[model samples]
Target: MTDKYVIPREKIKQLESLLNERDIDTLLIFSREGSDPILPFLIGEDTIHLGAALFNKNGRHIMLTSKSDEKKYYESGIFSKVKTYNTSMAEVFLKELNEINPGKLALNFSLEDAIGDGLSVGLYMMLEELITKDRLQKIEVSGEEIIRELCSVKTQTEVDCLRRCIQITNDIYDEVFTKVKCGMSEKEIGDLFVEGMKKRDVINGLGKPYDYPIVCIVRAGLAHRSPGDTKTIPGDIVIMDFSVRSEGYVSDIARTAYFLKPGETEPPTDIQHAFHTAYKAITAAINEIGPGKRGYEVDAVGRKVIEDGGFPTVRHSVGHPIGRQCHDSGTALRPLKENQDNRAAERKIQLMETYAIEPTVIQDGGLPCMLVEENVVIREYGAEILSRRQEKLYLITCE
Candidate 1:
């Protein structure tokens, strides 16, 4: 099945409804040289380069583009009504805004969510300079909440894309884990993942290509650091967190494995304890996920499992939204710690939303670090796990 994207009409209707509820007359998704991340969601297929899509609550949706990008927009056929600008984007934007004459205009900007904050300051300054004071007053509000709501729920196509990408990631993990040995360096194993991506015609999902598939052997740190020359040894636990990008969607999964010494049938005691605790944490988190549940509530349930199991409480949240970007914006499953913004986690989880539930445990005194990340989509009843569930720690017996 193909993973090409097409924004469904229902999403447009949903956005319009949100705008109406907020008394927003129009939402301007503006970008320069196709720099804004929100542009792709409004204009389907990730093809449009430079343009502005004005979604008005009155069902009068229109797109504006420079003459250079006009052809690209038209060719995609995603937007039916397209307007063109001759030279100055700022001047043309003002003209179009004047014509639309919305009483309350919303721009894509946010202080909390990075993905929703795609409109750069430079662009905002240019827009501010061109528009009249009266017009500027109408543009007071940020459309970030609307954008987040629009992106949080996955359409069938988006869910399918994520599923396919996740399957490929799982297959690559299966292939690479089978070849891991007790003497191989962490970098060597990471290179195998790189090779797997190349063979599959996919790219790394989250950060710099080399930094991902985080290979943490034994007591190494659990940050997004690059793989190092630390060699795997017998009785050592290795944790790998990795993701792949395909069709503008990404998949995130982390697995833990233990290299057993000669004649050892399973992982050591401490390793087993940590792994099982993490597994139960993730399972509890998944069970807690459902429509109408709060994100922090879900996080708390998983967090309780780790603490009850006598492991160190993880510094990071239980999980994050995963979509076009690995850490996709909206409704994060995290705790409302002291002095932190709690708005994202406070939002109620909705059906069809996807998240990566990672219940991690980090220890200092000889016990292994464990991060168990699994992708799931919220259904009517509960969250459905997308990846092949890792019920136990993987055992690597090869010398």
Candidate 2:
């Protein structure tokens, strides 16, 4: 089956209803060079030309774009009307806005004006001239909440794509375990990972917006000693964090492993204990996430387990969503700490959604530090762990 979202009419109808409910006349999705993820998600194409799309409460959809992506845009069958614009997007947008002239307009600008940032200065200035000050002031409001909610619910196609990416990631880690040796430099290990990826065409997704790749390539032995010329000697604490992207859908996975000398079945005792503690935290956090739990509650649950086990809590969120982007924005498993801007901390988990069940435990006394991350999709009762959970820390023994 194709990955394209075939039935978006119903979704658009819901958006139109939302506009009417809020007295919003139009919902504007603006992008320069496809900078806005919302536009692509709503339109179902990962690539797009510089363009702006307008959706009105009357169920009309309009688009402005250059020739670069016009064919793909039309073939997708998402928009009702299309206008090609060469020089000024702001002019085209303002012209359309004037025609709609709704009581209010919704733009996806959250916090420091994300939507406006992508607009050209010429377009923005021209827009300012056409719009009435009062009308602009009263009508302009952040549509981030709406966009977030719309993007949060994963369609079955997206979930299936995620599963494929996660499987590729798991396969890569297995390759790492088999080939990695005690004396290999961290960079060598990282190179091995990159090579493994080329074998499957899983190229690194770095330097691309909303693109997430196998990150933190390799952090080993106290982390300060980054993956460079530093050779990972036996008994050194090591963690390799990586991810894979397939069709714009990304998968995230991290595994901590120990290098044991020949004839050694396991690392020394303290490292083993630390690995258990981290595993405990991982399970605790994953179990806490599901349909009804608020984002903060799940973070707190993970933090508590690590702290109760005599480890300090990490500053980052315990878990983050995986989708079009690796750190896909929306609801998240965040800390209880409140801020006016933090939305993910408050939203509840939803069924059928996927998240990375990651909880980093610090083992100060050891040489082989282990960090564990697993992927899971929220199910009816609890999370369905996607990546094979590390039941015990992996051991890469000496040759």
lDDT measured at residue 50 in model 2 versus the true structure, 0 to 100: 62
Prediction 1 global C-alpha lDDT? 0.82
Each prediction's RMSD to truth: 2.3, 3.8
Compose the digit string of candidate 1's lDDT tens values, residues 1-399.
542335445567778788999999988876776678777666552324457788888777777886666765666455557788676666666677788888788888888887689888887776677785566876668898888888888887789889999999999999998788878888998988988998898899967653447888856655677889988888778889889998878999999888889889987787788888999999999999999999899999999999999987878889988888888876878888788878888889998999999988888755677887899999998989999988888888855
> Which candidate leads in TM-score?
1
- Which residue pairs in candidate 2 collide? 214-243, 236-368, 237-367, 237-368, 237-369
Global lDDT scores for all candidate models: 0.82, 0.70
- Give the residue spans of candidate 2 off by over 4 A: 1-23, 44-50, 66-70, 84-99, 112-124, 205-226, 338-342, 365-368
Error of 2 at 305 (Å): 1.4
TM-score of each prediction = 0.93, 0.85
What clash count does candidate 1 reach?
Answer: 0
Worst 10 residues of 1 by lDDT: 1-10
